[model samples]
Target chain A: MKEGNFCCHKTTERSEKEYKSLMNRLSRIEGQIRGIKGMVERNVYCTDILIQVAAVNAALNSFNKELLAEHIRNCVVRDIREGKDETIEELVVILQKLMK
Target chain B: MKEGNFCCHKTTERSEKEYKSLMNRLSRIEGQIRGIKGMVERNVYCTDILIQVAAVNAALNSFNKELLAEHIRNCVVRDIREGKDETIEELVVILQKLMK
Candidate 1:
């Protein structure tokens, strides 16, 4: 909600802890990308770089799991309880995307 | 080492479990990305989409951590024990990149 921390749209306000957690993960990922770039720049064996690439991909999956769980727990469930049936439809569409 | 699973360079051979694990994570990420794309297609709320975007980013970080740990255990450490000092330098550059 703050000026500089507009990491997400204002549809839902994340708790301070949630926002920090998300930011922390992103910062680490930025570092990882820089590391990958460095490997390429330095020509550290091609296979070596590939290994890191695979690792980064896996990290991404874990991230999705964490936030998706949080979304279901905090946002979607509450919206549905408050009689927002459209949110359920929206969630279903999202699940379809994830399962694809 | 197989023909179809050229997920990484031939620098290291992942065990069956490791390879499967990496592949599984990637498959899930592919699904997650597709889900995000679906949100865009449906014209979902911007904030909702942003939350998912943030989630994907975090997942990527986790993927990197898993693969990195495995790389150190199987590749870098082994290379060092086998008297390849260059690998140490390579790993240090990698570490510096990650810590950046």
Candidate 2:
């Protein structure tokens, strides 16, 4: 592949709507995180804090899953169609790491 | 702060050298991944494959650590300096998720 083509595949572009949605989710998560910090500072119970932490974790994981799914559908699939076997391996490694 | 300033801190810019170095490491990992696939196709021992998987995981984690460190130093620090407490919460959440 041409260097430019390779470069293009190296990064994914998000539409404005997609970007706004992601930022909105991130901002909401940010608020939850601050709440957690306030809980920490106010001597909240460990179990309660842990529960909130778990929720935050689940939220972030959900976000990451969506991003990874988009990556696979866009970048990985494009690379495969363009005859880039290396990207397949790259993606496999990425997925295994994410799973871990 | 102006919206442009906020936008600037929202993304981190990497130097060419840094970008090249990351891509090099990624490429090496990619090759290792292909090797793993070949091993799988040839019916390599499960333990052996698992070991390689662990190595790849470690490498990827290391890469992520470096990137996150840079992010904290550049984007997060700048945001904090600019009086964006929200970014602090964002980063704390990000770090907590990364740790998991």
Q: Residue A41 of candidate 1: its Cα lDDT?
A: 41
Tens-digit per-residue lDDT, B1-100, candidate 2: 2223435323335566655655565565555556655554454433344456557556555555655666677767877999988777776766676666
**Number of the top TM-score candidate:** 1
Interface C-alpha root-mean-square deviation of candidate 2: 16.2
Residue A79 C-alpha lDDT in model 2: 76
**Tens-digit per-residue lDDT, A1-100, candidate 1:** 4312754443446566765665565455556656765553443443466557656655655656766777788777887898867778777777766654
Stretches of candidate 1 off by over 4 Å are A1-100, B1-10
TM-score list, all predictions: 0.49, 0.47
lDDT of 1: 0.62
Candidate 2 residue runs with Cα over 4 Å from true position = A1-9, B1-100
Scored by CA lDDT, what does every candidate get?
0.62, 0.56
lDDT of 1 by residue, B62-98 (tens): 7667777887887788888999878778777777666
